[model samples]
Each structure stands twice: as structure tokens, then as C-alpha cells.
Target: MSSGSIFRFSVMAAMLLAWPALADTHTPEEVPQTFAEGFIQGVGVPVISVYHLAAMIGIGILVGIAARGVVPVLAFGAAAMLGVAYQLSPYDLPADDAFVALTTMIIGLLILLRKPISPRVASGIFAVAGLVHGYSLGAVVANAGAVPVLAYVTGLLIVQTAIGVAACAITLGATKWPARRTVLLLAGGLVIVAGGLAAIEAAGLIG
Candidate 1:
């Protein structure tokens, strides 16, 4: 098989392994506030676990690569899937963490709509996003049982993958429109602005 086909199969295998772990780890309960409670309570259900988090990082990389080929619809589909996966997860994050995730998602989407960024750059941003996401995962892991922790991480990976895939489609579509190039530039600018904002927040420069 071709390299592309091999890669696709690998991704599929990863997803298949990740999904069962998610289902196995889930518990029926309302979302928890603290990470400890979340793990024990299995509050996030379908999305919590270390495996899921790794999957998300992988998804982001895949999306970055995919953006070079697919259309915007594909990107949208990916984002939608990520969102759905997040909603399904048993891990609940603190409000601030949720805000960060939302901001990152927006940033990812904007990046997709604009010009095609270098994969390295996209991956760097993804790494930062992953840090925040991982912290949230850690919190749940600390408080919950091993099973819940596993499930939560799994959820994160699935969602991240979806987001990355969506970004790929958007970036690919943007390349075809001359007029859209301006929008793409603006989107990039927004990413810079968002990054600045995130930095400020991290430094405790803003509330």
C-alpha cells in the first residue's frame, strides 16, 4: 500500500483502540468541578483519558497535513466532530480551562480560514493548546479512578483530531479564492492577537 494509505490505516487503528477505552472508562454522573472529583465521578464520560489526549495531538497533526488537500467542508466536519466528542467526554474542566479551550478552537478555525500556515507553526500552536488540555486531563486523573482518567484523555484526543481535520479542510479551500486571501491574512493576524491575549492571561497580566 501507498504511504498515504498506511498512514490512514494507522489513524483508523488508533481511533478504534481509543474508542473502546473511552467507553470502558465512562461513568454516569454530572460534570464535576475539581479534577479529582471528575475522575472519581467519571463526570466527562466519553472523553477522559491519557490515550484520548495523545489521539488529539495526533489528530491535530493530521489536520495540519490534511488542510493542504481537502476543502472547507471537510474542515468543518472535523471541527464538528471534535466539538461533539468534547461534549460526550466524562471529564469536566474548570471554567477558565474551558475558556482557554474555546479560544484555542477559535484560533485553530481562524488559522484554517486564512492562508496555509507552515505545518511546523501549526504544530507548535497545537502543542501549546495541548498543554492546556493536558493540564485539564491531569486534574481529572488526580481525582478520579484510573478508568475515568483513561476515558477523559481518550475524549480529548478524539476532539483534537476532529479540530485539526477541520482546520485542514478550511486551509485547503481558502487557497482557491484570490479574494479570500485577504480574509486569510486577517485570520492570521487574529491568531497573533489571540496568542498575545493568551500570553497576557498566562502571565497574569489580564483578568
Candidate 2:
């Protein structure tokens, strides 16, 4: 089957699993207000949150699948940092988990395609994903005070940078594998599944 076919099937499967009437529900985890005194729960919680971690991992893999460089990852990191700055500013965006989930879907689809896209185009996509993710991180610490907020933003960037680089390396290395394409297709499908679960949870239909 082609990449497009795989993506379409993944979407359909996700939609079926996310069916409002048939899905099982679970409570979203309570984000702690603080993490060890002065350590910055505002930043720490989001960093360790399963949802955020999953998103980061998915994004990293997508970047790797598309190309074999760190530019895209850096692009995402730069935009995300800007997003963190925006969060600290006098502006706020609605805390919507669905938005994040949708972005995850986009990244998964990109990975599913497994196409070699232009560096500029890939960088742009990663940048957009980064911005949204950064904003999400910022929301968690919006009320954690200046010090914790700073630490949180810094931590997010650091963690993402590490994850992104590692993901790129792994994908690049997979190129030598005889079954690289098949493995990537499976990874893309899994990412889609993760995104679907996230969307369902965000919609409050399940956890």
C-alpha cells in the first residue's frame, strides 16, 4: 500500500476509535501546581506530562522521516522559544488540547508520507508545530510566577532540543536498514494512533 493509503486508513481507524458514543472515558491527570519548592512545577509538569512527551516524540520522528538534518528541529526549537516568549507576554490563547492533538496528526501524516521535501518547506512546518507546542508549555506555567516560568521555558527548549536531535539521528541511521520504509510506516501509524487518543482526550470524550 502507498503512504497516502496508509494515512487515510490510519485516520479512519482513529476516527472509529474516537467515536463519542463508544469510547471509554478517563479523567485527565491533575497537573500539580508546584514541583519541589523553587523547582518550577509550572514548567516541570508539562515537560513530564505524557501528552506533551508523546507530542514531542512524534514531532521529532516526523522531522527525521522527512529529511536527514537538524535544521528542521532547530526551526521548531526557535519557534517554540518564541512561543514561550509570547506566553510570558500580556497575551493568552485558549487552553485547547484539541489544537495540540490536531498538530500531532499533521506531523504523523507528514511522517507517513515519508517523502523527501525541501528543507525550507520542512523547516516551516516544524516551526509551526513548535510554536503551538511552545504555547502549550507556556499555558501550564502562566501562573507559576516569573522564576518558575523562566525555568519552565528553558527546560522545555532543552528537552525538545535533545529529543529532536536524537530522533533525527535514529531516522538517519534507519536509512541503512533494508526494511526502513516498512518500519517508518509502522512508526507513522503509531504516531497517528497516539494523536487520535490525544484528540479524544482533549475533546473530553475519553482520557
Candidate 3:
């Protein structure tokens, strides 16, 4: 598709994704009690939340652009897992909408900048971003049992890895065509919008 077409499609997709998310809503209660429960929750939770979904998708795309290979994906996953650990530990940092909103915005900026970063640099960026995103995700299972938490982490890694890989592939493929690269830039702009709105909502600015 042409860049314009891709941009238009991305705009529509963003609107569809964002419209429902505009409302102030809470995620339904689904504590991970059993391994099954944890696995289900882990697989489902990231996409269900708006900022989380954006962050994960943005991460995938950025990784695809900034670095080549699966190592960056693994770095993101591992760092995210570590973030979860920190959240569940005494070193717990903030895990609020505001925090995630910031992380998402950072991803947006990185994508929008369009600067060439080395693989090492990209890996570092992905690690830090993943940690922030993971910390936020850890809130859902902060108190789960060991077995369930294990299952939950496994599920999360699997789902995120899948997403990262898919997004990376699509991004790499699309960018190969000079006319299609703008689509990713426009998509990055959407990520910024999403993050900005999330921050606004978090601050009770749009009520």
C-alpha cells in the first residue's frame, strides 16, 4: 500500500482502538489464583488495557526498526520480567497509569525521531522501556502464589514475544518499501496521542 493509504488505515485503526478506551473504566477483577487462572490472565491482561497494548505494540515496532534479530525481543521480555519482580519486591517503583503513559510516550518519541540507533543502543532502550511496561503489568498479580505467578510470567512472555515478533516482522517488511515507511511514523504519532490521552485521563483533566 502507499504511505498515504497506510497512514489513513493507521488513523482509522487508532480511532477504533481509542474510542472505547476514552471512557474511564476499570479492568475487570480476575486475580490469578490457579495456574490456569494465571495463564489466562497473563495472556489476556496486556491487550485488554489500552496503554499496555500501545506500549507493547510500540515496543515491537521500535525494536524492529532499531535493531535486527530476536535478541532485542528477548532483552525486552527479560527486562520486563525483572520489572515484574521489582514490583513484587520491596524495591517496587511506581506502577500507575501516569508511569505507563510516560513510557508509551517515550516509545512514541523514539519512533517519531527516525534516527538511526545501533543494535546495542536499541537493546538498551528496549530494556529500559520493557522494565517500565512490565512493572505496570505486574500490578495484576502482585500477590499471586508461586506456581500461578510462574505460569502467569510464562504466559506473558509468550504473548509478548509473539506480539514483538509479529510487529517486528510487519514493520521490517513494510519499511522495505520506501512509500510505506511513513505508515510507521504515523502509527508512532498515534502512539503519542494514545499516551497523551492516557496521561490526561490519569490526571483527571478530561473529565
Q: How many residue pairs clash in each candidate?
A: 26, 0, 0
lDDT of 3 by residue, 67-119 (tens): 56767777888888997887789775754668767877888788788665677
Q: Please report, in order, the local distance difference test score of every candidate based on alpha carbons.
A: 0.43, 0.62, 0.72
- Give the worst 10-residue stretch by lDDT in candidate 3: 19-28
TM-score each candidate: 0.43, 0.73, 0.82
lDDT of 2 by residue, 1-207 (tens): 455444443443343234323432231234334443224443354445545555565566666666656787788778887876777679865644666677777777777898776778878887877777777666655656666556656666777777667666566555555566776676666556666777877777864
lDDT of 1 by residue, 1-207 (tens): 344444453443344345433433213444445445443433343244322332343333335434543233233323433443344457544463444435444553544453355555555554545544444444434444545555555544445445446444443444444444444444344343444444455456654
- Backbone-clash count (model 3): 0
Q: Give me the candidate number with maximum TM-score.
A: 3
lDDT of 2 at 158: 72
TM-score of model 3 vs. true structure: 0.82
Ordered from best to worst lDDT, the candidate numbers read 3, 2, 1
The residue-level lDDT of candidate 2 at 72 comes to 79
- Model 2: per-residue Cα lDDT at residue 166: 65
